[model samples]
Target: MPEETQAEQVEPQPQEPETAPEADGRTDPWSDPEAARREIEKLRREAAGHRTKVRELEPLAAKAKELEDAQKSEAERLTEQLAAERERAAAATRSAVAAKVEALAAKTFADPEDAAGALDLTAYVDESGVIDRDRIQADLAALLERKPHWGRPDDGPRRPAPDRTQGSSGNGNRTPSDPANDFANWFKHSLDQAR
Candidate 1:
């Protein structure tokens, strides 16, 4: 094979015109320096505004969380308090009813000692007139001055005396005229008897 000469090695080349149309026929959007700069500034400002909004929202989110936590805590506390109150009320009711039942049993049996032995005092009375230990205890404690005993019917319960100073003159066998006063007295009496 002969060595190729320099002129032969150089290939003929064709040249096109310097002016040409863009492939998509569109100019660069950033060709306007001022407009491009303004666009960049606008983007920067928008980003800054977004950051500011985020900062502002952080505190609001935190406050919302705090409020939610506080509400949950308050709700829990209230629920516990309500449960405790209900338990207290139930206990009071049971005790009062028991006292009434004991008193009723003593009267019905006509023998305090025998009545106590024979009765499950809570079962003797209902809201209407059922006899139960709880009812007996409540009635005796509320109505009687002396504590009721089951040993023997030596004497009947001592009824409360009317206050002469208050001009209250009743046989004392009936409940007080004022419902609140009556309930208070009865509850106090029931508590004492239970103890």
Candidate 2:
């Protein structure tokens, strides 16, 4: 409850100045404009060296781009060449298939009479040897125009029909033609359902 002394209430003050280190009368190196100019000059020299390096590498960068472009062009050329080769191979395969078809047709129509009277021979055959519907139709038209009398069903001319008589199995005795013989070896409709 006694009164507080003024000296006890007062705080101690620091001896250091509130400003920078220049209070000691010594100049800071960064404060000199001429020294700062020298530092800036050094930085500019380093930047100039970097600029020189960039200038020197410019041709290399351009060459790398050129190489990349060349590689791309070569890849495109190879892709085109591969596609063309595949097309050629496909064409060759088609040609081989056509040849095989021609061989089969020749085997089917061995006789001239069979070629003329049986199925017109040209109805399902084409010049390309393939059984294309449009090509076969054209060939059939040509054959009909060439042989008008051959396709005439109304012509009463007695042409000898081919010997389609079925032989007996094991019996040596020959029997007469059966009344139902016409339906025995009839051509099925399943043979004409192709596209």
Candidate 3:
């Protein structure tokens, strides 16, 4: 047990060289070319297996993408169809309202445009496509009451006054004053005399 300096006190032992791990974990195969070749072949087999799996799934992936695209196109077509249907419905409704307004005005007044201008057509039509006739009549009556001049006379278009001179006989004698002794009756009498 003599005292020794730090460098001298330490003794170096024979060291084993470190090598890379093998597949079996028991031996270092780097030194043997045959073992390295076997490992490379094993890795190549594994890579081939992975490639085979990817090949098997390729068709399925393509089919899934195709189905997704089909569904998207179908949805877009349905959306366009819905929009077209809505436009058609709106146009039909507008035409129906205009026809109804024209018919109502013609039935109630002399001037259809003036009658249409006085009432709200939307109010008289319900969602169920039923027209409120009573309400329309009431509204029309109220309108006529408010503007009394809007009421059309029950008598139709006026006719010109009859020409009394045309009914006189050519013999310088005036026709009878009786209501039935008009030009028509006198013409019938002259025709009977000729027969």
Number of the top-ranking candidate, with lDDT as the measure: 3
Off by over 4 Å in 2: 1-39, 106-195
The C-alpha stretches of model 3 lying farther than 4 A from their native spots are 1-48, 113-123, 138-195
**Candidates 1 and 2, the one with greater TM-score:** 2
Clashing pairs in 2: none
The per-model lDDT (C-alpha) reads 0.61, 0.56, 0.72
TM-scores for candidates 1 onward, in order: 0.38, 0.38, 0.47
Writing each residue's lDDT as its tens digit, candidate 2 over 1-195 gives: 121254344354433333355867855545554444467667767988999999999999999999999999999999999999989966665555444334433433333242234333334545654555455345544655666554435536788876644565466576666656645544344445542
lDDT of 1 at 40: 63
Q: Locate the minimum summed-lDDT window of 10 residues in model 2.
A: 1-10
- TM-score winner among the candidates? 3
Count steric clashes of candidate 3: 0
Q: How many pairs collide in each candidate, listed in order?
A: 40, 0, 0
Tens digit of per-residue lDDT, candidate 1, span 27-145: 44354444445676688679889999999999999999999999999999999999999899667765565555545655534454444544454455466644454555554444443
